[model samples]
Target chain A: MIEGIATLATLGFTLGLFLALAARFLKVEADPIVDDITAMLPGSNCGQCGFAGCGQAAEAMAEGTATLDICPPGGKGLIENLAARLGVDWDFSNSTTNTVPMLAYVQEATCIGCTRCFKACPTDAIIGAPKQMHSVIDSACNGCTLCIDVCPTECLQMVEVKTTLTNWRWNKPLPLAQLPLAA
Target chain B: MPKLSIRGGVHPDEHKLTNEITITRVPTPERLYLPLKQHIGAPAAPDKVIHEIIHKGQIIARAQGSVSANIHAPCSGYVEQITDWAAPHPSGLPTRTMVLVNDGRELRDDVSTPVNPLFLRPEVIAERVSQAGIVGLGGATFPSAVKLTLGQSRNTPVLIINGCECEPYLTCDDRLMQERTQAVMDGIQLLAQALYGPDTIIAIERNKPEAIRLMEIACKDFGNIRVMAVPTRYPMGSEKQLIEYITGRQVPAGKLSADIGVTLHNISTAYAISNAVRHGKPLTHRIVTVAGDAVKRPGNYEVPIGMLISDLLAFCGLKEEPQRILMGGPMMGQALPHAEIPITKGCNGVLAMSRAEVKNSTEHPCIRCASCVDACPIGLSPLTMAAMLKKDKLDQAVDIGLKDCILCGSCSFACPSAIPLVHYFNYGKGELLIRGQQQQKDDEIKRLIQGRQVRMAQQEKEKEEMIAKRMQAIAKRKAAEKAAAEQNSEKEIA
Candidate 1:
């Protein structure tokens, strides 16, 4: 029993020393997950997720401090993806954030030839000359609200995306509980 | 070649109510709402301004892209308006539609005289077919011209005509085969020649012995054409399934039958092609089986493309308020919200079912009986896929052959639990599509953002450079002015 214990102790000591050396000498400088998350993110750096940027948001997400759904721009797909990656059982069906996709609409009539909104736009969705009324390209606008805050004229507003034949999809089937009882 | 049997299938009660009924005709309605996107690919685009008059057989909207069909006026009518209107879909959403008001006179324009299509070259025939805007009437709605071109390009060795109206409560194809045998045969012969004299087989379901008999009689003179009576199984009419049953071959996933040196066309499509080539007729009308218990007159009707379902039902007469109204066959048909939807080129059946006909069972949890597995014609695991979907693992489900699903509804029909397996699949497919669209939008946004970032940086750099250049020029001008002033002052001092 003494010999067995001595041999085990020696092996443990040697292994522990090797692990310590490896930890010290071969330590990773950055979390690989942060980079992966940054790649998946919108990369717009719109700061709508309450973080300084997507990189910071990814850092917080990696550290488990930020929920996957914290970024509105990422949408439900991102949440599900992140949940899957992190091995979390995210019940997306019951999620309250069934937010209708919003598009930045420009109130052209009220807009005073201010280039501030365009300057703040991350996607260059706004188009106009410096002193001319600006218009947002519906397709390109990310609805980040950065332009909204910077808009001195308050011309930019988030409008729910109107359903067109191209963009519209079949409504999801109602759950059994939600389905009305047969007459 | 070894026979690749149908992977999985279900035997639903073949409610061939209108199988023996002769084809009938319905009068033109007051207003016909024709949708732009009746066929697959890009929707037919109208170049006319609002209120423009369109005559019968006039090309109101031309096919925009390679894989599209032209939309012709079924009746001489003035354009009422082009606006979003109800579509014959389950979603009940409005799509871009051209409303035409019938003037009671069907004045056709540019009616071409008959030319023997057999004398024409294959490419010429293809051009005429594309101009006629004929699509597969087998509910697939693939552009017939495009399919012909594909067959020609692939050097197809066999041509299989799909006469299997395997869907329950739909007998439009059967009726067409029984009535228009010669035209369909001519179409088959013409198609065979266009496809470089490929061996032709008209595959009809054994259930429709009449269609089979008629087709066989018509194929007597054609040495290459043969009428085949295949098993009357559900989805036996599917191009892949029919090819498998007759040719003993399997069309690889993500590939057409042409890839395997074969081409398949529907019976209705063949008839349409015959009409288009012989009479120079555009695809403006189709035989629709208006059946089910609720319909007063359960028979097949040759319906105008833009005619409203309400008008058709008014002519047929409904016995009572239908519990469910479907635009196609009951098995794979869409449950339409109302009867205001207009008929399209692809629609084959208009079923107004009662509660008894529609066996709406309470959805029960899967019993893990694997009935769904047995019923899937594509041999996909509907149960396991559903489980993955429940876990929100859509990508995982896709990995396990979700893309091959044909939405045949055989699994749901086979399920004893009435679990609505097809509904789950529909949901999954829609979710995947939506997710794909979202991914595309995200990618587009990312590109735009990156481009904007680069542009902003370039603009800033340019602005800085412009400012520095202006400052240098101002300083140089000031130095030159000072030198001139100093020279003038020195002159005065001298």
Candidate 2:
């Protein structure tokens, strides 16, 4: 029985040693980054980001190749993740500090016959062509700055178009509002 | 009155006269300018050089990454020039487009190469989807490959196909379900096979009875797949809302649908998948609903990717003049000042309304009507959030569930006073993110400052100690010299 136990112990130790050696030899120098980047993400995978997807974006973020603020859809969740992953300080004060949802508007009178803005918009939010008045295709527009930079006649404007009844949301009032006694 | 909703939301006349009509195909244009960026994600990059001969479904541009969708040649044509031009965007931005001058033959090349996707691994299927440039054609344009990967990793148990074309005046999905029901069902079957036979459910709003019937019949043989009708409500097509209505699951804010063992894909996306899998075709042309009050002939037509809105309007027989052209439905669609914009994959409808149809009521202050409160699907207070955003109190707004606002435009649509409530929520959300980013930066700077001060103080202490030691050594040397001089003088006197 003792001999049998010894043999078993020897086999277990041998297997453990082999595993340790293999682990050392085959150690993938995974950019200690991919996991770090994954943690920083909002993890919604909403695809508002332009990467192949959030996983691809996370991989890119880990590799230190992709921009930190590329995800406008993930917005702050994305920014925070990127900041944590890179261990860098983020200064959004000058970088469009307010996250006010921007909408595309056109100065109908100023629009020239050129269709510059239509081609520039990433979401195909604008509709118009050469020698004609241009318009904004609202539903597909994500308010990316690609369209604003493409207008030749400066006809397209990124206006904080007021959210009307058609777009307004009903936010739950604070606890104080529900209690007339408190007021 | 079936619990008539109150608060914020505009009842743009449904104008769904064209909803029941069948989809028609538009003839090839003289020159088709295809934009690389169509979806909400990363813009695609062109693979072909200037003046390259390209066939239909030949991917003109490749999706940059998982977030980006692929771009394909809409027709068999010679590439003219890869130039930057104004695209169909509200920003009136110039984007890189592959200009293809049609040869006028309208001859479609056989780019469809069948692949036995059934035998391949789920990861392999996802890789093929990525290569095919598939995306959510539901206007979000999220890459399909990434979604599949998420489902694979998370062990998704169900696949919910969104056939609920809830937006008024949009009937593209309805037409797709009616005309291509089998294809959609086939795509779902393939998706199920990829996910180890997860139950597939097609969720259609009750209003689209024809679509529900067609989809149900198509999936009759597949016991795992079923068709369920949800309430006919606005934004019933939203990813979160649809999941809740069908499965009683609410995908938490900042979490994916896979987290709840559910995978949601749009109906058009399923059809695209079928085309890619069976026909070996990449996404090129899509069904677009061209309807509004001003058009003489309002109908749904299958259009190429880069056709001008003007051509589509003319084909529909434009009335005297349109007051505005909006892409998508009236409630959530963006307004186009001109009709020069090119349609992309996400574009579902082209609305040209007469001035009479678009006389939006003037904006008024919220009267605390509590109508918006009732309209909120997520149970948010739109007015409070808007007010906080107005005061630049972003943190306060966030505390009140600003993150939950889906921006479905339902609250805004429900508002009688024409208040832009959704705009405020969007603004608040954006501001909260910006402030959080700023705080992160400030914290980083503060740490750097503290580290530098500690180092500087240590260096000062070291310098002072060195100086003190040197002074003590010099005093010792002087004392030794004085003692030697005094001893020498005493010897000379003796």
Candidate 3:
């Protein structure tokens, strides 16, 4: 019985060694970019990029299949992170460049008081019901511009809310100013 | 009740009253202000001379690159002024613009059939689209040609048409479906032909039964295409959401719909495609929904691109001075500083609101009600993210999955506290980006400084070595000279 046990252990060890050797021989070169791109991402599986999750987004980024500006919910932060990590330049101006933060508003009176739009909103930004005036959840709007297209009463509109000092953040400067800001 | 969601999104009240009256084209304004940069990507450089007489559909601005869209004269008019003006920007900053004084001729002289896209290759089709200034009229304003190219290169299997106008107070698309059904479908057919054969699907919200019925009927004859009614949801009209909802497949982040063998085009874009292809017309005008509580006459108008918001409001018979003038739908729209800004390709709706509608509710602290979380379609904790962002700990926010946020406004909409959670995210994102840029610059500088120091040290070492070798050679020569002198003296003595 002891001899049989020894034989079994030997067989297991031999099989393990063979598997390890096969793995080494079959190794395909992995693109190191996957790790870099993954690190750049928010790591949240929000599926905001139309993907299944953030990990999938990272994979796509490594594959060069998606644009760096694909994340709308991530907004400018994601774009900047991606640009920095990928060593790419990105224009972020609002007039002609990407990364302008936008909000959504609903036309209240014209809303027909139907909850169709409320139901259609993925973010539940609209608050009202059938036979009641609907209002926009202004703070939560992602500015994806999806909701503006579906209103039966033509009540939904994507108006850019004015960016005041209350909501303003200092813009990122050109690369010449490499020093970190004083906290 | 817990609201349903599928992906990144927000719900805003759809104030569509301004457009609910009926469809009417505002009488041509005395002057039309056309912005040189109307579409997405780079703005086209003005090609025409400052005062050169231009007609409708005349290419005033040509596409500069693959990402840029073209710009055309909306009506026959003379360039009155070419100057910078406050555009409809969140920052309320002025941008370069072109103002035109309308001759009220409504002239469209430059009309002719271009090379038929059907007979031409896909590449030719793309070129014509580029020339037509065609963009995704669905508010994205992305160049149609680029989308087409992306689809062709990746061999996208299915084309999804977005018909989910879920935002409140905007019914331009809905009306377009109701009124221009045939034109829209024709546009869809052209898009399909341009893309992968006729394997197309029209994704309409179940709420728009009429639109669904019309689209279904229109597409019935086209065996390769069909209409699909997605469950009505805010941001359901989003490309990612619609794609996932329809195909049950999620397009990975950092990837495109084409990567998953799918491509999406707006119904309006399809219409533009048809207009550009069949009518041989450049994208000069589109259907805009003018809606709000303040306007006496509200409805959809086939307004030309670059028309001012003031003219539109006046033409509609201003019932009251609006408290807010918004471009696009309320949920995802932007509030205009005033009505001076001209319309662009991405403008789909204009809303005028009374003081009452614009009044802000008193904001309160969060009660930990978990309402925002419940309302979030992508299933995110808005309260936590907002708190982290408030503390200026963007990295921690990111650690909590900040990248996954869709900014759909559901949380804010559901928040009883009236906290601008989405705005906070935007702020946090902006701050984070600034920090990232600074970090990148620092790293680059460090690399350069290190390289310079290393080179300087190497040069110093080389100089010292050269001096030492020279001194040694000189000493050897002196010693040889002394030896030779001594030998000469000895010879003389002998």
Q: What is the TM-score of chain A alone in each candidate?
A: 0.77, 0.48, 0.55
Tens digit of per-residue lDDT, candidate 1, span B1-494: 42444668877898897888889988888998999998889988986668998888888888988988998888887998999999777876898899999998888877764568888788877888898889889998889999999988988999988888889889998988888888888888778878888999888878998888888888899888998877768888877777887878788989878888888898888888888888888888999999888989989999999898889988999898889999998889999989999999999999999878778688776789999998888888999987776666788889988888888999888988787777777778887887888888888999988888888889999999999999999999999999999999999999
Predicted model with the maximum lDDT: 1
Please report the TM-score between candidate 3 and the true structure.
0.66
lDDT tens string, model 2, A1-183? 999999999999999999999999988886657766654553434354576555788887667677677666345545755675587766655455345655678888888857777655544457777888888765444455566666776767777636432233334322222323444
Cα lDDT listed for each candidate = 0.85, 0.75, 0.74
Weakest ten-residue segment in model 3 chain A by summed lDDT: A170-179
Which candidate's DockQ is highest? Answer: 1
| Per-prediction CA RMSD (Å) | 9.2, 19.8, 21.0
Ranking by DockQ: 1, 3, 2
Q: Candidate 3's C-alpha lDDT?
A: 0.74
What DockQ class does candidate 1 belong to?
Answer: acceptable
Could you give candidate 2's per-residue lDDT for residues B1-494 as a string of tens digits? 12232223334345668767888999978888788877767788888888888777677887775588778787887899998766666545577777888887666666635466666677777776777788888888788888898888888998988988888999888888888788888778777776777888888877788888888888888889998876667777878877776777668888888999998888888888877876677777888998888999888899988898888888889886998899887767777758877887888999998888876766765789878887887888888888877755565677888888877788888888778887777667655555565456434433533454566689899999989988988998889888888888988887
Superior candidate under TM-score, 1 versus 2: 1
